[model samples]
Target: MVGYALALALPNGKFDIAHAARTPGDPVRRRPRGNALRKPAGILVVREADMDELGWYPNVETPEAR
Candidate 1:
């Protein structure tokens, strides 16, 4: 399973992962359908063990979803 992490640029000038979600695959690679954020940047803070079990990259989406 792959997961998602959100980083928010706030007034306080601090970066944080707001949300996390998981999907089946290495990662969910998706392009915005319309005019959304040009590119979303963030980080994956999950444990290495978790990734080993899931065997996912992070944000790589599948062919059907694309």
Candidate 2:
């Protein structure tokens, strides 16, 4: 699983990975070069009980008409 692989890649095997699924890197292919998912920008993670709440909503501004 992606989560398990990520855990092994971290420096101390401890992390608060929020958005670790957006990455498209193939771990099997990039593992040789120490490919690990890094924290993404503008992302948040909330943990509740037995399940985690994950969301990836992006905010893009629309240009006003000239």
Clashes per candidate (backbone, < 3 Å): 8, 0
Worst 10 residues of 1 by lDDT: 30-39
Among all candidates shown, the one with the greatest lDDT:
2
TM-score, cand. 2: 0.19
CA lDDT for candidate 2 = 0.36
Which residue pairs in candidate 2 have backbone atoms (N, alpha carbon, C) closer than 3 angstroms, thus clashing? none
lDDT of each candidate versus the true structure: 0.32, 0.36
Angstrom error at residue 42, model 1: 6.2
Candidate 2 per-residue lDDT over residues 1-66, each given as its tens digit: 245444454552123343333334442443422322333332333222322353336744448422
Q: What tens digits encode model 1's per-residue C-alpha lDDT throughout 1-66? A: 222323333222223332223323423332121113222353333222345566456868899669
- Candidate 1 clashes: the total is 8
> Could you estimate the TM-score for every candidate?
0.18, 0.19
